[model samples]
Target: MNKLSGHHHISMLTKNGKRNNDFYTKILGLRRVKKTVNQDSPSMYHLFYGDLTGAAGTELTFFEMPVAGRTVRGTNAITRIGLLVPSYASLQYWKERFQQEEVKHSDITTYAGRDALFFEDHEGLRMVLLNHHGHEVPAHWQSWDGNEIPEEHRILGMGTVEITVRYLQRTVNLLKNLFGYTVVTESEKEAVLQSIAGEVFGEIVVKELEGPSEKPGRGSIHHLALRVASVEDLQEWDAKIKEQGFDSTGVVDRYYFQSLYFRDRNGILFEMATDGPGFTVDSAVEDLGKKLDLPPFLEEKRAEIEAILEPLE
Candidate 1:
């Protein structure tokens, strides 16, 4: 049986790479693990932020689009991203911190049966910080050397990602019948599905709404990448997707990890990515995100790429 783990990395679009870097690293207290360009679009910046070494599930990435417009909210989308925090107290700390930073946010509240605090980035990317409730996600707290965030109160990693579609049952059916996930909670309009890998980090919430597809722009989530065990696992899934007659981007080498992309019946794009040959492949753990790095395929165009891109720092 193939093992599809939790999150690999959730990719979104950002208009200003510099401000996005400042918010995620300094404000949210995540480390910039990689600074590279999008492989498909070499001139655009691809920035990654995560815990210490940029673990697979911990990575939150952005592709910079300099002239992108605002996202028009609607259904048939990956609506909200969830970040895991250590405790209830950590939520309070972040609540105060966000207020001080003038970030848009909401009061502490309950979401999907966990204490969660909803917030948004400058460009209106929706997010929530959920209390992990002693979940054993490998978030390295002592990794920050000069950072001022308290050791005990730091964001762990991503939690449940919410997907809103017109037909929740079709999406739920795809996750269950195709991906082998179990429903944790279910209702007429919303349902939370838990991955077989088993953790809040690997789960997804599906909501049904009668509306049009989301008009995506800056601050819009491009896709959600689920974690798979290895390159071999991805190949098996690639074959399975073909066997099922679903449209897919067959197994592709991403340099860091191998992956395959396919849209579910609901039209939400999901990538199954491997967990190894991580960000540390190009740079040392301590030196990660300190400088621009590119894969071998894109190495020859570094000078040209750098010339066209705006400085992130």
Candidate 2:
């Protein structure tokens, strides 16, 4: 009965690596923590963006699939992503910045009794800026003076993940029974779940929608990963998943962190990953995201991989 922590990271799809790189690192102000290839598919790029060191719960990642078409939005998908800012005033700062940069965004409004502003990335990726005003959650933000925005108003970390499912209760049950989340709020159409850690990052919004399954492509979220304390916790969770009649990828040695993956009843991919041996394993902290990084298993094929992939910079 190992309880899962909050969000580790949310991985999405992007069509243009260079544009994705610019939008996140340059426009959004999140540091490009890692530049690497997708382990399962070396032909594609896997880019990670986060706070100074790409802490566990702060990552917002992308997999570049140049040929990927537009995402066909529908049910049973991770719909909207929420990014946390230091305070309610940060929303105003971002709103003004978005206007200046011509970033598509909505007027500041309240969602679930919190001040929030909605915006879209270059690829129509839906995002919301939520206030972390009174959450007691310390944001893992360290600033470099060169960013377009100031240090106090920097985008902190991932706040919440919203998932839309055809069968709501099944997904809700998985969150409660398997993941050990407590439902904090609920209505006819949605429910908000909080993890044991009880912070802004631990919140999840589950919405019930009746529609066709999502046809994923560019801007579509691929999976949502939750944090596990250690490899021992992951192994225990792996057994629990199988015992309950769910198929899992077991323990995978992702060079940075070990991961176990399984889909929910709604087909939303959920991953349990450990926090150790992070982005600095192969590259120095200062040199991270500066060059192409490959794990030892893929080192031999680096030349072949590099030749096929265009320069992401």
Candidate 3:
């Protein structure tokens, strides 16, 4: 059985940190659960948006990397992020809102027997609001602007994501053999794999691509992470990845959660992360995302780090 609960979070690149915050918190009505900096490059911000409590599977994170430029579409990168909604009425509500906000979006379309509203963020990050047909419905968060978005229509959490791979079978094997994902649905061009146990947040639609490899930049996915039970589980998975001849990052402390990163056959980055000592580790839930927080190792440079980061509205 898969030891993972479901999707822990999906991290993507964005050009402007402030705009990214507004798009998610204001427009999408998610809560800004954590405001921190990229561990690898402390100057750039690493922001997280999720439910009121920053629950697993609901978290969507971003790294502000404007210098990376816009993403180049091709094989081996995550394409669309799907957030779950309650019903068809929610889909209808989004269509009208998209039109009013002048956000580019597609009319509701059917996929896997659910209604999906496809759209893009200001930075051209593809996204979807799909009905939670077979997934657990997480609690909706109160928007910072107070009741701007109705509770019913608010997004539940991260639902599904579309990934483009060069060869379908190789990627499929890795998910099935390693992650215990089973083929829930398949078509000529794409296939949907779900965790054998998790009904929500584990949906991964693999689409075959015929083109030059994707060039990473702004709006490109940094990595997609799956939730593990504990640190021991992470170590076990790390060993499994190495046994499969795929290079793994072993284990790294992410402060909130320990992580292990590895790339697939197509070089798309994947991470297995534990869910504990979370955002509340450094700050209280009420004060989350209100101020900048840093890991203990970086505490000495807090003053220097604060100087470089632009103020968020």
Candidate 4:
């Protein structure tokens, strides 16, 4: 009965690395924890943004693929990503800021028993901010001097994410058997699952479609990662995922952590990632996101790789 702690992060495809960096880091006030290239494709950038420490649950990563098409908002894809704010006061601050910035948003809604504010990023990626009542905000994330957003107001982590699927039972089963989640509640249109460790919650909703099924596109979720306790637990789950007949890529080193990825029945990519040796592994706590870092394996190619990446600011 190995269960995931909760979400590690969600990866999204962005149009420009620098622009995405500015929005998440500058406007959204997340810390740019890492600046590196995708291991599979060195020509593209893989940027990570999160709390100051880049802790397990508080991260959102991106694959810079400027030429990709906009994500179509229907059927068999992640619909929205929700981030946890510290309190109701913080939510009010964000509401005012969003209005001041002229960002389109919806009125606060009560979903799954939490107060939530929904909005979109520059690329139209739907996001929600919620007041997470029971969770403690990690000490290292109390203030981010970078975005001038105080630590008291930083994002707690992902609250819940929506996955719209056509085949509901299969997707629900995979989440339970493979990821160690328990069904908390369900409606005719949606099912909500709580993680084993209960650090965060998630939703898998069913959306009926009329014609052909849609493919995962840009601005759509690239993958959702489930946090494992350690590398050993990750390997154990790797075998389990294979036994369940899902083809998973065996452990791949992500510098900050290790990960194994496979697509779910509906083609949404899912990753099981370890929770250790975080961003502080290569850099000091005070120096994270201050400069680009190359993993030992990529160090030799740094000069060439840096040349291909468009400068951020």
Stretches of candidate 2 exceeding 4 Å from the true structure: 138-146
Best-performing candidate as measured by lDDT: 1
Model 4 TM-score, all chains together: 0.92
Question: Can you write out model 2's per-residue Cα lDDT over 182-227, one digit (the tens) per residue?
Answer: 9988888899998864666878999999979999999899999998
Candidate 1 lDDT score relative to the true structure: 0.88
Clashing residue pairs in candidate 4 (N, C-alpha, C atoms within 3 angstroms): 142-151, 143-151
Judge candidate 4 at residue 207 and give its lDDT: 39
List where candidate 1 sits over 4 angstroms from the true fold: 138-146
Task: Indicate the residue-level lDDT of 64 in model 1.
Answer: 96
Q: TM-score of predicted model 2?
A: 0.96
lDDT of 3 by residue, 1-313 (tens): 2356678899999889998898888888888889999999999999999876687778999999768787788888888888888889899999999999888899999755568899998888888888875444534333233437887787887777888988887788899888888888777778888874446577888999888888887777878999887898889899989999999999999999999999999888999998887888988778888889899999999999999999879
TM-score of each: 0.97, 0.96, 0.95, 0.92
For each candidate, what is the lDDT?
0.88, 0.88, 0.84, 0.77
How displaced is residue 304 in candidate 4, in Å?
1.1
Question: Which prediction has more favorable lDDT, 3 or 4?
Answer: 3
Better candidate number, 1 or 4, judged by lDDT: 1
Residue 168 CA error for candidate 2 (Å)? 0.7
lDDT string for model 4 (69-180, tens) is 8776666777789888888877788888789877777787765567988998888888898888647644434445677665666676677887777777667778876666
Q: Candidate order by TM-score, highest to lowest?
A: 1, 2, 3, 4
